[model samples]
Target: MNRLNMGRACARAGLSLVAMASLSAWAQSGAERLALAAAAPRLSEVVVTAVRAPQPLTDVLADVTLIDRDQIAQSGAVTIADLLARQPGVELSRSGGPGTATSLFLRGAETRFTAVYIDGVRVDSQSTGGAPWEAIALGQVERIEIVRGPAAAVYGSDAVAGVVQIFTRQGDGPFTPYVGIGAGNRRTGKLEAGFSGKQGALDYSLGLQRDMSRGHDSHPGSNPDRDGYRQTAASGRIGLRLNEAHRVDLTGTYTDMDAQYDGFLPGLDDHGLNRLATLGASWTAQWSPAYSTRLSVSESQQRYEMVPTPPYLSRTRLRNYLLQNQWKEGAHTFTGTLERREDHLVNAPIDQGRHQDGLALGYGYVAGAHTVQLNLRHDRDSEFGGQTTGGVAYGFAFAPGWRATAAAGTAFRVPTLYQRFSEYGQPALLPEKGRNVEIGLHWGQAASRLGVTLYRNRVSNLINFGAPGACLSPFGCFENAGKARLQGLTFMAAHQVAGVNLSASLDLQQPKNLATGTLLARRAQRLLKLAADTRVAQWRLGAEWHLASHRWENAANTSRLGGYGLVNLYASTTVARQWDVLVRVDNVGDRSYQLAQGYPALPRSFFVGLRWTGR
Candidate 1:
């Protein structure tokens, strides 16, 4: 089918799903709805990344999503990127299978535009301008928070598109230990163990995981050998409650990954090595009922290298310090923060370092039916003088379980050190800036919910590779020669019917480059997702459907990437009073597709695992 016909078909399908959801909601009896609501667990009611502080989900004015530990386990995803791609307004691209180069686009923005944090500690690569998603182990994460819009006003830089925060397990209650083992196709295997507990005034949690796989050939046209990978990861969190008003916390994580891939020289064996480590420490004090303060220090190290014939190595180290104060009185809350960030990069002939000092102020109000939030921040960079950003949001609860929200924000991202000092760099390039506005209507009651959001974000001073002129490389030079407009409408619905939980989301977007009047590379104009889950006897079963419209492979719109659909299924059950069993199958149809031009998507695969928890 042609692109136009495919797009129309997707649109019709989306409409049909929406209609079905509405009809089901209307047909449900009041008693059934109430029963569904009563049975629902209040697991994810509070989120912190939306406003840099913990707030109830209903009071938040920004677009956000929360994923709990149970959701993570049920996802049956091999990597963090793979799980994130299942979310609305998010997309993923990979050059190969697990433990390979990967990119995530939030709201159709570049990977670097999204700021990522692990346990309140920032992790980024100055060489690539984004986090190393492939190196981060998914088994160690306990919770995830995603904010889906520009947030430079809250975070200093690298937040033009959104912000993502990952949290490791924290200890509570009595001592608990768990172990899990799994095996799958492609000679894949995994083993994980963890323990968490709180004793007296101290709490601690630690986990370890290892994974290995003989993956498929990523680039079949080049080398025919089976690409393989191995990974090892560990995470720990410890907290000390000195007193009722004072506390201290420490968090750390480390991961090492080695993957074999086809290089330029086909016959020879080549490998890529990646390592990441992060450490953070913080202290908090509550002086009074209305006042509190926190101080934190964190550092992250990232290194990547290619072996043998094409020897290459790059390392990035980032350090952050923050002092925060919060005051609360009646229905108003205020915050003041002072932060410092230092970045250092070592790549071949270039070793560079830079620092930024920032001050931020914020205000939030939640009274009766009205909610408001405002934020302002200023950062002085060692190389680029100063940049200021601000945002405002307002929400009004007009009726029972109905709310209207409007928000506008400004964001910016400074050029990476490698983008300035490398062989293809340009020292005089300006920082990229973004302006965004959005409005949403949401209604929620019990187990039924609906939301519609419309948004438009424009970016200026965009950077692209152009003809060689101001750099040492003859092939091309980095230049600020592009502009982009990303506009979209998203619809989401959730309803329970006949003991089954149903959810659907549709995203219609236009991510276009103004310079060439064409669609951005690897971004679809339409996306739809549907999911259903139910429990029968002793087993819980779930299925997911994912669909996307056609996309362009390049900015010129010369090459086309066909759209595809995939079905995934998962089932879990508990037995022997202490063991949990899970089975999952992905790409059920064995459909052939590609995320990148040359790379092939993973075929139909199955995995089964057994986990035991000490009671």
Candidate 2:
């Protein structure tokens, strides 16, 4: 992370500004705009889960954000990270460019504590935890619903931070198909297509997309390597319904990704590869109008290769299998989940393993203007066997269109493979565990949404990636160094005026270790985001700005990464009834900022694409 590498990211930001003026096509008449403006308030009525389940955002008793299809099309984004990076209480980072393994943090929680799901199926790592954001391309998505803050109530372990659920389309129509191809700077190319159809009582859909970048110098490569990255992915699903009493869904996905890190600087020349496959099926049926049940089962396998491919070096393998059942009766809802997971690692002559079987149960009810939920989980871990964790939550309607909520939960994190059995490194550390308490408020009306939340987390057995050494110098090790507390506030507000929509969010966190009286390094105490989106006729425009507070890279008084702010712009317009165009400029300030104080930040760049909106 030197200035030269910083400049590479800056260059990319500067290139995006020039792309905005190029939007606004000659087509897209005035009539279409009038039709949408009249039907705008009914936009949410199109969602199935929201309608059939009918859990109001405030009823969940937690802080949540829903990005519907309209917003996705309006943002003109090409990847999932693009949408998340602009959100409140979340930040995403990579070594340099797209298709690289991404890290996401919620509030001040670590990456592994967040859980990701695709169509109700868990997509996170079986061992390390957390989803690989780069592996999820945008082409196949219908909409995304993100529940931020501790979520031990509905989901299982590693949900101490939050849950991000993605729902792919299952073909809303019959025989609908689309294909697209595009290219950008640094030899970036994209190919994507999907089709949906139905016959009688059954409906099905499939989609595929690939993105590749022969990236530029977002950093000064030690060996003048081109810093290349590529990803290929495809997903398919089938849905069947019988007489409105029974419903079934089956899904499958495959992804492969490769990136040449070439090390951000000298001696960091490591290449990484990740491949994953997932398959799952679910069934939901109604015994009557007042009582219903849902059941699902899934399996997934993922392999990680670092440095020199598989056989020649270090690698990690993860396998996960899960089952969940839920029953709804009157105002009462009960859910049960059972899962088995394994994480296997190989580092030369050293081997480490972790196996876990966990079950979680929850009950929720609505009384008067208040909603209450209770949760419990039973787990048997390889290192620590037979444990139960749970939480309680309450949401009360305070006033017209306003709700208040609070929750308290207990959670734990398993030890890393290297922490337990790295023969060439430290091997004595144990698991980390913690408790979280939070409170929030939510309010929404016709044209606006406002949400605010306050939370605190106390964690013990915090793992430390120990300092550089001779016997254990560059390779890194770990330990249960100390206990700490993280306290923060998250707030977001969005509103529409005239033809323009505006949104803003702020995340403030202070993490400290009581034992050492020191702030946790590389974790920012404050982050802020602001954006504006407006549409006129067929033309749409959006702009964003972000600022992050500085923090230490290490507590030993080594170095500090300075604070910086970055900006981005997006614009799009319809070309014809079937075609549309998009242009985006990211990191417009060309600021050389570090998300972790030293790791290289992404460079300034621009991307343009053509898409189709309807069949």
Candidate 3:
């Protein structure tokens, strides 16, 4: 089925659901809605990555989402991709079960367009031009910040779609320890242990975990052998305070995994070793009440090795240094930043390196019912002489609990080493460039929040395989495709009805190649997500649903992948003091589906776990 008809059908279905919910809400008395609102907890207020500094989410005139630690624990999701799939303006396509290659698309943008960061360090690989989404474990993350728009004016290149920043867990209050274990279908099991503490002027956090699963067959028809996956990960963070005006901090995360797959034939002999690690340090000084500066340095590495066949190895490393200063005067604030980054890659057959230096300036104003923000950045790359980008945003409050925002920005993504130097590569390929504009409306109170965003983005110089007559190189065939456009609508609402919590979102998007007028590959035109959770006495119960519209698997648009919906249920309770139990059932109906063609998704799985905490 084509997306146009599917999108309309999905739209009608979504409207029906909304009307039903509204009627149900109206059935309740006005006082009840007020009471429900008064009792519901407010969303997390503070965010750091949107502007590269600390600010309230409301103060930023951008489409954003913040997943806190408590939410992560309550969602009963095992991987970062699983959690991200539930967010608005986001979609995920995994090749197989856990510990497999997964790709994330934001607002109809390509996989490489969205930048990923561990803290403040950019972690996308220089070899593949994409982040290892499968390697990022959710157990070590304290929070995740998602900004769904162009941010290259504040960050460097590779922010065309948006940015995802992950913060590692840190210590709080007194010394505490935690341990957990789990067993589930497919012969899956897990072990986890961690400790965290805070002293007079110091804080620390450490964690270790391992997971193994004898997964279902990836190729159901031809391959009946069960694939397997194993992962061991560790993470730590430390902070030290020199005085009231100065502080220093260090953080590190590591993951090592082995995953089995079906190669040419169905055999257990095909496996790969993957490793990801990031380390960083930062020093912050408060020179005065209105002035402050920070200096940070970080390194990120990703390595993959395939065995039992023709051996293959590839590794990528990134090093970064940044210095920024912020000054505030009344309702006006200004910031200046300088950054340097180096990227190196080794793929056995080829080795490459590049460097980039960048500078950015930002200004913000907030007073009464108006807010304004502006940023400009210039970057000089070793290969691509220079590029400049800028952004401006304005927000206005017309009434209590209501606000409107408009923003426009430019962004770019540099070509990876494999795209430039390897066989079938094009060295003359230009970096992809894009411009985006969005307007959003937000309404919220303590009990409920509602948001809607409309956006349009245009991209040029897209890199792709060359046509029959477009190739000029003897060893490769690559060319710069003309142009593309992506337009979308995002709707989100959260409310606490009586004692139960309800949240829902819908995303409708159209991504087309300007030259051919064809939809982009692997991006659904419509998506819907709904979640409900509540606590009664010592028991917590939750349910989630995700629906996606039809999408094409290839640019030709002939190979269509049907839409699918999934339902999940979760329950947790405090069995004893400092001890808890969690149980979950995924794909409750065992509906057959596929996010990506030729890759089968898991079906009807069960998991149960126990956790203990001590102080």
**TM-scores for all candidates?**
0.95, 0.84, 0.93
Best by lDDT: 1
* Best-to-worst TM-score order: 1, 3, 2
Candidate 3 local lDDT, residue 143: 91
Top candidate, metric TM-score: 1
> Which tens-of-lDDT digit does each residue in 1-615 have in candidate 3?
345875675567556654534211101111122223333433225678878988755466667677888778876687899888788888988877877778899999987899899877778876667888888888878899888889999988899999999998889999999999999999989899999999999999999999999988876664667878999999999999999999999999999989877666555467878899999999999999999999999999999887877677889999999999999999998999999989998986679899989999999988877889999999999999799999998887777666778899999988988777766577888999999998877665665666667789999998776654434456546668768888887767666787888877877888888877889888998898887888988899988888998999888788999999999999999899999899999999998888778778888888999999995
TM-score of 1: 0.95
lDDT tens digits, residues 269-332, model 2? 5667777667778787777766666666776656667765233344555556655556777788
Please, what is the whole-model Cα lDDT of each candidate in the order they appear? Answer: 0.86, 0.66, 0.82
Worst lDDT run of 10 residues, candidate 3, spans 23-32
The better candidate by TM-score, 2 or 3, is 3
Task: State the lDDT of candidate 1 residue by residue for 1-615, as single tens digits.
Answer: 344764575567556655765422211111122223333455226778877876666557788877779989998899999988888788888888888888998889989999999999999999988999988889989998888888998898989989989999999989999999999999989899999999999999999999999989888888878888999999999999999999999999999999887787888778889999999999999999999999999999999998976998999999999998999998999999999999999998889999999999999998877889999999999999899999998887777766778889999999998889999999998999999999887666677776767788999998888889789999998889899988777777778888998877777888888887888899998888888888999999999999988888877899988999999999999987889999999999998888888778788988998999896
Please give the lDDT score at residue 205 for candidate 1: 97
Model 1 residue 537 CA deviation (Å) reads: 0.6
The local distance difference test score of model 3 is: 0.82
Better of 1 and 3 by lDDT: 1
- The residue pairs that clash in candidate 2, if any, are 9-603, 9-604, 12-604, 12-605, 13-587, 13-604, 13-605, 16-585, 263-268, 469-473
